[model samples]
Target: MGDCTAQCLHRRAPTEGGAIVEDFTIIHDEGILEVLWRPGIGIGPGELDVLANTITHFPRWHASPVLVHLNLVRHITPPARKMLVAYHHAGPIGLTGSDPVDRVLAAFIAQSRSRTRYFTESAEARAWLSLIGVTAGRPVPAPAR
Candidate 1:
């Protein structure tokens, strides 16, 4: 989740819920460019570890400016928030729910948006990501303030 020296790759994911059973790779196949894992609608350490390990392979996007769409997932834990805070460098981490982000995540959202030179789009997550730096077919680097 921190840093590595490879490019990440992933195929279309198929999931069943309790845990994510998605294939995550980095620079393995031909033009494996970028990997995007749309896990289930919730997150746990189990899933996070899988995600962390998967991205570690693609140091480019793992530590670079990435667009993580969380429009389908809402619930979050403090540890998860911390991991997002410390490890991932996202453009606009898509967030949507009825009030699930809680106090801690809200603060991290605010801080990551305000302090870390990141974007938190309430309207268009992917659009914001693209606005910052992410493109449809390229791995984006960290965005500056």
Candidate 2:
């Protein structure tokens, strides 16, 4: 009998972000960084400058010692690494992960153990921050005299 075989094909879903504006900010006293992973579902080279440029849109971005609320990061490439570094305000950056990262990334994540806190879920991430007196999505109070 002649050789017979069946072949299978698969498709991958499209990424989410686009040319739209991505939302993320570092509120000094508020202690919460709201990040909107828009403009392109995944991270890339220009994305960093785009995000960092958002600093011009809002003054809060320039704040130091910030904790960012990174949510819905499905995939990350080398370019993503460079872009993320722009968020140099703090290490142990708060991020949400559903996809698996590479060995190097995993190692870096491990480093966060001492400097940052992590959560699979966003709600928990926020709670973890609050537990440490860090707040998110809330307004900061005026400095005391």
Candidate 3:
């Protein structure tokens, strides 16, 4: 797994009504809906509810490719994971994060869900998304060595 910290992956500021919501940020860029998961949080039914609400509020995001950054997520509850497998749209999905568990989970999810790939670097994940016909945001170039 490549440890590429490219600026192309950015957390979108979450907003509801007017105030900023710190739970998570859903960014719609280049054709994919990039989900920037904040670290130390667990994905439970409540979290899944928030995700459902977000998607409902942004109906235009339905069926869009999903780029999930699980670096910040601590764990996915079994129920939440089951919900994800059931509700996640059948579309191109890319997951990149630092946790070994996350990578394993991603692989498990990919077994049933096609077009899913895990990477240590967001840039490489985005590139894979592009190859699968999902338009990804421009990746930030690595700094001069």
Best candidate, lDDT: 3
lDDT of 1 by residue, 53-140 (tens): 6655653543243444343455556776666556535433443332344333445654553213222453453345445443534566
Q: Given candidate 3, what's the lDDT at residue 27?
A: 68
lDDT of 2 by residue, 23-130 (tens): 333333344444545322455555556556554444444432233334444445676664454434532345554434433343444443234554567677566655
TM-score of each model, in listed order = 0.44, 0.48, 0.69
Q: After superposition, how far is residue 92 of candidate 3 from its true place, in Å?
A: 0.5
Off by over 4 Å in 2: 1-31, 64-71, 83-87, 90-92, 99-115, 131-145
Q: In terms of TM-score, how similar is model 3 to the real structure?
A: 0.69
Candidate 2 global CA lDDT score: 0.43
Clash count, predicted structure 3: 1
Worst 10 residues of 2 by lDDT: 1-10
| Backbone clash count, each prediction separately | 1, 6, 1
For model 1, name the residue pairs that clash. 8-58
RMSD of each: 9.2, 14.2, 9.5
Model 3, global lDDT: 0.67
Q: 1-145 in candidate 3: lDDT tens per residue?
A: 1132332333234455776445666766666667776657777888878776775544455556778888888888888777767664656788887778888778656765446778899888877776664433345557898
Work out how many backbone clashes candidate 1 has.
1
